[model samples]
Target: MKGSDPKPQSYEQLPLQFQLYDCSAGQSDCSQCRAVPEEYGCVWCSGTCVYNQSCTSVPADTCPPPQITQVSERCSVLSSSQMTCPTPAVTPEVKVKGVWFQLDNVRVHYETIKGKSFTYYPNPEFFPLNREAPDAPYRFKPGGVIAVEGQHLTRAISRQEVKARLGDRECEVKTLDNTHLYCEPPEIQPLSVDDRSELPCLKVFMGNLEVELGRVQYDSDSLSVVPLAAQISLAAGAAVIILSVLVVILMYRRKSKQALRDYKKVLLQLETLEINVGDQCRKEFTVASFPPF
Candidate 1:
């Protein structure tokens, strides 16, 4: 038991048939025998242990997100076009059956055409009428009801018509191609409201007669006959013109003042120089008479 290597311990001495146990369930295991559970191992086991032998459950596969598709078309007729009438040279007539009030600066004429109908002719010459015609025929047909309408008919005659009738006074005519026809008319300023109010409702001026056709009441406070934007623009233009005039006047005054000041300074300098030269000549003459050194 000492230096003779003490008899080597036999398997029986080391408990060759000792109880084997599963360590996973805290069961005791033999130190020398092999009775391991499915994947349970002992502390002395050298190989890799398969503790979790059951396969893991996987999630179901999902589909990818949907993609957007674009569609193209050509020459498709518009729904509005299909619903509306085709563009024709002769537009349909618009009937304005109501009481008509014709007003000018001097007089207001009311004509009630009971049960009358007029064919709205589109005259290209009457550009601002919003009607397509210049020589629109307003036939006062029978069977039309009328009501009271008021206001000055300022747009009875167009500037072009006035120019044509008057043979172009200080006015230039612009053609369809933007070409200008220049003719100097006798200078006639627009009549003021007061002056115009004194004139007859229907008057002839310079061989051109103006008649009041109809009047539409316009509220200066609300329903803007002339848009606020346009009025503001006109006001801005006027203010700019006034400011320009004031600047020119101020510049002219400043230049004039500067010129006057410069002229005075030059005159003063000339007078001083002349006095100084005279005094020096007198001193030289006095010195020459006193001594010839």
Candidate 2:
């Protein structure tokens, strides 16, 4: 009876299972569809979906912490050539965005390679060595070059931050770099001889810090500089004039001697003529004395 009751079966007689949807089949093979790893898989797509296989990941940004290194400068001098004198170090401090940093730190970078040995210091490319200032008397002259070396010159990294002073007078910065600064000393017209002010000292300021480079030697106006070129020209001109005068005198003397010789010849001719005339007269008198015998 149970087998023949199909038409009268209630809803409870239906099968409990439903057909499962094949997401990984019918469209493409599982090998071709490729299963994306959970780490990079997208949440909106089904686990077998190929659309979420590629994901874009952005890296987080980080700032390198500040580092401090030891610096041992042998000396600081106005001239780069002269490092013999053990002078004080020029330690300049700069304020950037309300934070202060040493010039040596900001201007230089320490680099180390993974497999390499020695530490590398990346100095500014334009940094100069063998720079020397105008010596002594010349350094006191206007527009004289004053070379500043052995210190970090680019503290604030701008033209406005680099400043130089020769005594109280401000100097024009001609060339600047991390290690060297070339400046034109202000035209210090020397005070009168009665003025007793000492020569100005060369001072350079990187930011608010100051470094005394050297003192400009006093140049005296009393030291008469006789121009050798002018003197030589004057001597040559005088010699030429004297030689010309001597030549003129020699020519005049030669003309005078020639005139004297002509005058003597004329006198001798006159004397000979007188002698002949006298003899002729004597002959005529003798003939007359004979009385035509």
Candidate with the greatest lDDT versus the true structure:
2
User: Which digits, one per residue and each the tens of the lDDT, describe model 1 over residues 1-293?
Assistant: 56655687666555457564434443222222133443443332222211333213321123224334322222234685333111112322222332233233543212333344423333322112112342332222122211212222122323354332122122232321121122222223222223334211111121123323221112224422668999999999999999999999999999999999999999999999999999999999999889855
lDDT per residue, candidate 2, 1-293, as tens digits?
Answer: 55654577456576688644333443232333333244543222332333343323322122224335444334345675543222123333311111121345554222221333322222222212223543333334344576666544464345565677766677778888776788776455432222343656566665334665545654455334669999999999999999999999999999999999999999999999999999999999999889864
Checking candidate 2 for backbone clashes, the offending pairs are: none
Best by TM-score: 2
Candidate 2 lDDT at 75 equals 34
lDDT value for candidate 1?
0.36
Give residue 82's error in model 2 in angstroms: 43
TM-score for each model: 0.25, 0.28
Candidate 1 to native Cα RMSD, angstroms:
38.0
Model 2 CA lDDT for position 118? 28
In model 1, state the lDDT of residue 52: 36
Model 1 ranges off by over 4 Å: 1-226, 290-293
